[model samples]
Target: MAVSTASPTGSFGPPPPTTAGAIVVEGLRKRYGSDGPEAVKGIDFSVAQGEIFGLLGPNGAGKTTTIGVITTRVRPTGGRVLVDGLDVTQDQVAVKLRLAIVPQRPNLDRSLSALENLTFHAAYFGFSRKARRERALELLEQVGLAGREDDRVDQYSGGMAQRLIIARALIHRPQILILDEPTTGLDPQSRLFLWDTMRDLQSRGTTLILTTHDMAEADQLCDRIAIVDHGEVIALDTPRGLRKLLPSEQGVEVVVVAAGDAGTGTGDPLEAVRSTPGVERADVVAEAEGRTTVRAYGAVDAGDLVDRLKRAGLELVELRQLEGSLEDVFVHLTGRELR
Candidate 1:
């Protein structure tokens, strides 16, 4: 079966491909306990080949359950999953060969060296000793871990370990890579490094299915994102497309630069904002002692709001139209942000 998905721009491509990067899921449902509630309530979406598909959701959403079912770590009570047209349930053995999963946590054997870890992983897939060794070194170099190839896994930093995990997932060059919160605990530099690596992999025709709470990552990488919540698919679209769905009455925030007892926004800044042509409401934020922040939510232009503030005897330091991110979109759509 073919999966017809809308692009990030909310458009369609030529009809679904037959052999190329195609994934299909229909009425996908999975429940943990026989008598308990179902974790996944018949959700469905597909990943295109060479495309980065991001799975996003709040805590307790069925994101993990959906991944587990597709990867065959858990069985679906009723549904269909096909990777490259291979039925996940019927051909579990073969599907495993074509799929690689990067779990949310670092599961590397602490005692094993980087080289040893990849070597062991490769051998598990039946690679010859020499082949495993060569491939391990090659992948280490690819992920910029060549210098640390001999380092013990336990000593590897969060980012370094993530790279190794990604490289290990690619040792066999699976058609699809599933990443669950791959960069959760990493520093800024490490997160950026992983982003680069992901781009490189996509260039080589590797389909990527990833999950992350980081809005920037999803916006930068994912061709489309599936916003899951409470065991259901709430929204699925490109990051930009999702942003467009925000309420027409977008809000603008302004920081006050008033002088002489500016602590309580004593001046007329609030009046100036409310008087703006498009501004529906505005007020000073008392969260900070010296900071006077004004936030307005309505069909108002941020530029106009800024202009109004300047004319009202208030200096414009910085002004921005805040259209909350994917997290905000999730919260607006699902009534909660993904943890």
Candidate 2:
């Protein structure tokens, strides 16, 4: 789906009584203190119902702050956010009732048993004694904790605790599930399990808003992505659409052993590769033991890159062709330097 990008100075009026999506963020802005830098600045986006929307960016790029506004944890300094057609600031309680958050860090009740944790949360939403009990048990079984429901959460592994947290979030049967770095510390197996769980929830018609730094995870799960940077939405598109923003769709990684004692070729390999036809961008990605890996993206020809590197006095050790990915789109938009 095509996504729109909002300008920094753009003006956005309040949403009507109802909106077309589950969430709407319009010209949102937030500043820490009177003189503090704006954590989020005039951002705009909307998440369709039942879509797995992603807020992707580097650390401190306002992804979390944007989520805070949507969840009503942080007050916006300017503009507005609407959750399920209800203004976040004006309808905080009603909005909260419709949203469930799985925070970046584990916020499970360690003192409570796994089952108690789920039931206790459900109780807040006014579930009756019998209903909460049955719901908790059902969720425990769904999250793979059926036999361990009586165990204290303190004894649970990181993965198990995460699962319990997910179950707890669902106790209220929220309309929108907000996952902030849901799989940060999980092992591959646990991450995959959570991905399956997310898909299951989506299948049941739950809208998901995800904040993540993991490019692969976003690429694999998000229906559409909003790339935020320095408190603004720089780009918004589907994964495939975002990939098209790059100059070329193919990439080549050429690993070369320096032919000289300087640990570099006699000539400038980077310049030579960049000057090669069909090569749009080139960067030295890695270097160790006299081998330097140059990753170039564009309509790159592996054979041409090898021959050019050879002419530059670099001996080819390995060469590999790669498909364009969200990571490349990120680097292209956010720059190659670590923030």
TM of each candidate vs. truth: 0.74, 0.75
Quote the lDDT for 41 in model 1.
Answer: 90
Query: CA lDDT, every prediction?
Result: 0.78, 0.84
Tell me the TM-score of model 1: 0.74
lDDT (0-100) at residue 241 of candidate 1? 80
- Per-residue lDDT tens digits for candidate 2, residues 131-189, read 77877887788788889999999999999999899888877777788999999999998
Poorest stretch of ten by lDDT in candidate 2: 1-10
Backbone clashes, each candidate? 3, 0
The CA lDDT at 250 in model 2 is 68
Q: Model 1 misses residue 291 by how many Å?
A: 21
- The count of backbone overlaps in candidate 1 is 3
Q: Show where candidate 1 strays beyond 4 Å.
A: 1-18, 249-323, 336-339
Cα RMSD (Å) per model? 8.2, 10.0
